[model samples]
Target chain A: MESKRIEQLLNKYLNAETTIQEETILSKYFTGLEIAPHLEEYRALFLYYAQSKTEYSTQSIQLKTKKQHWKWISAVASFVLLISVYAGYLYDQNKQAEYAFEHTQDAFQLLSKNLNRGTNAVMYLENYKTATGKVFKELN
Target chain B: MNQAEFLSVVMPFKDKVFRMAKRLLVSIEEAEDATQELYLKLWKNRKKINSYKSIEAFAMTMTKNYCFDRLKSKQASNLSLVHNNYREKGLSLDSKTEISDSVSIVHELITKLPEQQQLIIQMRDIEQYEYEEISEILEIKPTAVRVALSRARKTVREQLIKQHNYGIKEN
Candidate 1:
């Protein structure tokens, strides 16, 4: 009688019409030692299913914490990289400004020296003008 | 959710996820990698995890997609050399020791099925998910899941019986 029920359930299972409960019954029936010889061909298949269910991954699952830890570390590393890059850029700009300032100061010094030479020429001209005026007065 | 809460909720189904991955990828190591990848994805999207109705279904769907992507990229790169190697390795790994020769034949038969049928068998027969759950994970109608599952079961059955008959004749 039990074997008859098993046969029906197995048929239903093959047709994909069996409920989970019915399928469970069928799997349980196959696991037993007394499976009818005519039905014995399916024993390996059912046994495979049963064994397959036991195949939990022995590899440990790495939780989010460990992975998140890596995430945090990488984020910090990238942030530090960005900050140093920006700082180097700022330092370069400051150096460029100082260089420009030094070049301009040198340019101003050269211009002032030329102007002083021109002022000395103007002083010579003034002396010449005074000497000519005194000669004109002696002629008068 | 917080990490602890998310872990408590999703950890219970980790094995199921791994099994789904293994079924698709066929190599334990590949499956493990896929499982790890899936979990990392889940963790990254933890904020939206609760929005789904079934976390298990969502995780299984993710596993399926991720494994398929891996297989596609692998095929693109290696021309399926590693694919066959993994199938052989999986057969050997599964058939070692007390497992009979017939069992390995079933494993081979399973690998021969299409990806959809393979997943259906893995979930319905081995993992014993309900049709509703299978439908949700596969994003197919329940009737379609049943039809595919029935076809898969019948194919495995016919092939296994034929192999058994041949073995008996040889002996």
Candidate 2:
């Protein structure tokens, strides 16, 4: 295609007016080793598109390394958090059990004191009843 | 998406992802970091992504935003490193002779453009994304995408011509 036509197409391309097929044509045109001198500046831009695809770099390895480091750090942090929460829960349960045990012991002690007082009172009443019976027999 | 599905779709696009990062951030190291970060983000939110149409665009958008955030942070710190690094390595092509150095030059020039223009070039030329997809990715009207791309192309073309003329004069 003539340079003028190509320039027109390039203009259209810049305007986003070209179709995918037109883009392919432009890509092919620019890929040639020999481009017109005036249009040579655009050669790099189009050629880059035509020939350039993605390629992995050593930087990607670095990225992976950093990622792995962060992943481990995050995992460790989460594990510690879980452990801390579980320990807190266990501590709370133990405290509740201790309080319940102390309350039960206090209740038992109170019950024992009441039983001892009742036994003493019963003994005293029995002795008084025996005296009263002896006095009634004498009066008779 | 499941992890495996996400991996299958995104793994192939790593280089593209990296290139976009590199183009936007102007640093290989930072670009690699961005790519990994982008992937991790996508993995974390895999369930929210419903279709491929939005997936690629969303990834690109994430990359753009991430780069922008980095840029802003760098600026806030008053760190001269980012712009200095760009100046030092402006238009430096990789060691692949199969691709012309001019491509790198164009890429460098593209980096100097505003964020919107740079993104349009990335999607339309480099990624071969459709106009509608570019529009969606940018959240701009399709017509706006076309106009921005056209303007960006003209700018790059002018810079290339200037450089070419300088080269010819020196020779």
Candidate 3:
């Protein structure tokens, strides 16, 4: 409290012999508004420290990298998902086309077989007409 | 730890980290950047945060290392001409300028000290760290820390007295 005692503490502080509590006393002493004239020179140093303690990072913290990385991963994942969905769609379309073509081929083969039978039947009928006319001619 | 937990654990000392960085660095912007970078790192290593006895000390050590590395960079040296430039709003212009001048003088005198002493003062006086904590941050013996801090404060005190007596660098 007294300048004499403060001076003693300050000396101890300069020697780094003071305990943490004692050092706090010195810091608190120098920090007051009314410093003794002889000790005024030391005021700025303590004031600077006190002033610095008040200095803080007012800018809001933005830990962007981690969030950005997760965003990037999601983007890539969605991109892969889109590609897979498109690929699956294309594969399904291809299978449906192949199945329909196979059915059409089977139906065309059946149609051609029946058409061949019809052709053979017409040929037999034509031969029968010609033979029947010949027999008629012979009879005539 | 997760963001909320990491923030709760480390947020209390973020300003302390900022001040430490500000002390080492020449500019508030650089200090702010360093503080953010330090927290980002702490966040990344949040899982390991519990391993250290005191997260604030760990953060201060990280801040010290980061700022020192920054000081070595060409840009930081260029920026060293600037120091704390904040204002006490209600003061008259003359006293404001006077206080600012005195503040810069102490700050400049501080910057000229050997880097170790300057760091010790910052840790001991400005940051008010425990001797053990300062020792851990500086990676030195507690006795050595006390010696360095003594030397640092004496140098500043003598220079300040000389300046006040003769007005040598006042212009």
Candidate 4:
């Protein structure tokens, strides 16, 4: 009776009308130890299908790197670019500040030198006037 | 989806993609290359991958198309597949060779079949995909999938029975 049911299922299987469940049942029957002799050739056929499912390529897929790497590279590049631009701007401002400081120093030195010279001249003039007044008083 | 979700969804079926490619391509090397190539392309469009209802089916279809393109290119250069030369390793040589021989015979017979039937058998029988699933992958009607699959099985069965009875391998 079971064989009769399997035979009917096999017919449907060969016609491709059986459900996947029926096909699975047929596969199990054929792959089992006791395949019907008349259906022996069909055994290899089902066996082949089972064997083929495990026939995957040994090559590993390493798609993790390439596109993701490019994204990281571009992000790093822009980051470096941003840092360099900001650094250059900071350097320029520092240079301008240093130049302004040196210019102010030079201007102060020039003013001090002129003022010292004027003070020296005024001291000499006062000395000359004092000496002339002493001589006139002695003559009177 | 994002990378984690994408990998979880796709990596499980990555071998299935490779197997599908192997079915279409000539050698293991070609199939591996095709699988990697298909995955890379999928990665590039991974952002839109979630839009697909069944990413596994989509990837299978992509693998099929990519491999066929490679096949066509090979054909354009006047090259053809040399079937029946593949060796299954790691088996103790003497005992299983006879069975493997039978298996190889069936494999050659499959390759000799017309393209549509070959793919139909691969999808329906070997991959154990549902008829509706095979129809979706192959872009044919469900009834048409059954018809083509039946015809392919019959061809295999006839040749296999002939081999058993006559002990002669014939195309």
Candidate 5:
């Protein structure tokens, strides 16, 4: 195509007025082995576009691999979080049980001490009763 | 869709996604990060995405938003300059030797433009997206997309011509 025609097409391209066929023609023109000196600057841009397609860099793949590892790490972290929460709950329950056992033991100790004191008072009263009965028989 | 179905649907667009991210971020590393992030975002918001007419548009928008969010946060932290320099260094190291000098120059110039213009060029030129689709992805009027694209292409062409002359003079 002539320079003027190409320029016109380029203008149309800029205005988004070019049809797909025209775009394909423009792309073909730019990709041709021969390009004008003035239009050389645009050759790269068009060529880049023509060549621009989906590409995956090895580095990107590596990054993706690392991301996969991170997913596993995050999953593990979540599992650990759950386990920690459960352990904390179990710890609280054990503490409550221990507290209840200690209180029960204290209450039982208090009852046994009072029962022994009551028995000792009863024994002293029994000795006094026996001594008073002997004194009444001697008087008769 | 299920994971396999979603992956198959999106697998065809991986290059498109990569190019979009590469254009937006100007770094392969950042682009790769952005791609994975975009995919994760898609997976997270897959429910809402069913309403979208074009999954490609949806993915592109998500990628753009993610890149802008990172840029904004970096700016807010006052680390934009430092981060930019660091990114430049990384890009230099990871630059594709296969790409021609003109392509590299064009890519660099595109990065110099405002984000909106850059995005418009990418959508129209690189991705071959229609004006209506671009509008939907950008949430702008279709006319606005055309106008921005025209101005962006003009600027790019101008820059390319100037750079070409400078190179000839240097030679």
Candidate 6:
């Protein structure tokens, strides 16, 4: 009589019509040692299901908490700030060097132009001296 | 929600997520990684986490989709939907010795099942989810879930019986 009931429950179970309670009953019936020989094949299936349920993940979950997130964000932010600051310093240094170079070039150009003017005055004085010598020679 | 509250709400189903991932993924490490990834995603989106009707169902669906994508991706070339993690926990040496072979055979047969069928079996038989919950996770109608589950159960039953008979014949 118990076997007959289990057969009906198993049929319902196979058809996906069994309620959770009835399925539990079927599982219980299958797990027992006195299951009929014909129904014995299903023992492995039910046992496997029960065993599968027990198989929890052995690994622990590691969530990056908000504090950690902030830690990382701040770390990255500081690194970026450091890089940009160093880059700007390098750029400013370069610009200062460039400015000094241009001013030096202008000063040199001005000095050379003034020196050329003095040379021109000296050349004019030489010409005047030669002309004076020729006039004095003429007078002699 | 705060991280603590979010974790309190979501951590209850972490094992379920891992188990479902293990169902779809090949290795325990892969499943663990997938679980962690899913949780990280949920944690990132925690501001909107409470907007969902059921976070557990959402997580399961995400796990299923993530695992399927992983399986289809290029790295999944070496990965197969093999249920090799059927462990024998807390059982006596005698019973473990008896059921180990049959349990492994059932594990092999489960892996041989079709993709949808395998999910249905895992969700229904192993995980003991209701039809509506299974439908929600798999995004199928309850009727379709029932039909697929029935088909999967019948297939496993047929294959398992055949294997059992074959073993008897060999003995």
The whole-model lDDT of each prediction reads 0.89, 0.77, 0.80, 0.80, 0.78, 0.84
Best by the DockQ measure: 6
| Residue pairs of candidate 4 with colliding backbone atoms | none
Off by over 4 Å in 4: A64-140, B80-99, B168-171
Best by TM-score: 1
The better candidate by lDDT, 1 or 4, is 1
lDDT string, candidate 2, B1-171, tens digits: 555676777777677778777777776777878887888787777777775566778887788888889878878998796678765653344544445567777756777899889878887787888988878877789999888988988888888889888988999
Q: Judged by lDDT against the true structure, how good is candidate 3?
A: 0.80
* Local accuracy of candidate 1 as per-residue lDDT tens digits, A27-125: 888888889888888999999899889988888777655767899999999999999999999999999999999999999999999999999999999
lDDT (tens digit, per residue) of candidate 4 on A9-115? 87888788888788889889888998777777878888878787876667777767687799999999999999999999999999999999999999999999999
Here the TM-score of candidate 1's chain B is 0.95
Candidate that would win on lDDT:
1
lDDT (tens digit, per residue) of candidate 6 on B22-75: 777756678888999999999888988889999999999999999989878834
What CAPRI grade goes to candidate 4?
A: acceptable
- lDDT, residue A106, model 5: 96
Candidates sorted on TM-score, descending: 1, 6, 5, 4, 3, 2
- DockQ of model 6, rounded to 2 decimals: 0.62
Candidate with more favorable, higher DockQ: 2 or 3: 3
- Model 2 stretches astray by more than 4 angstroms: A1-4, A55-140, B51-53, B86-101
Reference-based lDDT, residue A130, model 5: 93
- The native-contact fractions of the candidates, in order shown, are 0.77, 0.56, 0.79, 0.77, 0.42, 0.77
Model 6 TM-score, all chains together:
0.77
**Can you give the TM-score per candidate against the true fold?**
0.81, 0.68, 0.68, 0.69, 0.72, 0.77
| Sort order, DockQ high to low | 6, 1, 3, 4, 5, 2
For model 3 chain B, the run of ten residues with the poorest summed lDDT = B85-94
Question: Could you tell me the interface RMSD of model 5?
Answer: 3.5
List the candidate 1 regions with Cα displacement exceeding 4 Å: A1-5, A63-118, A121-125, B44-48, B73-78, B95-98
Collision pairs in model 2:
none
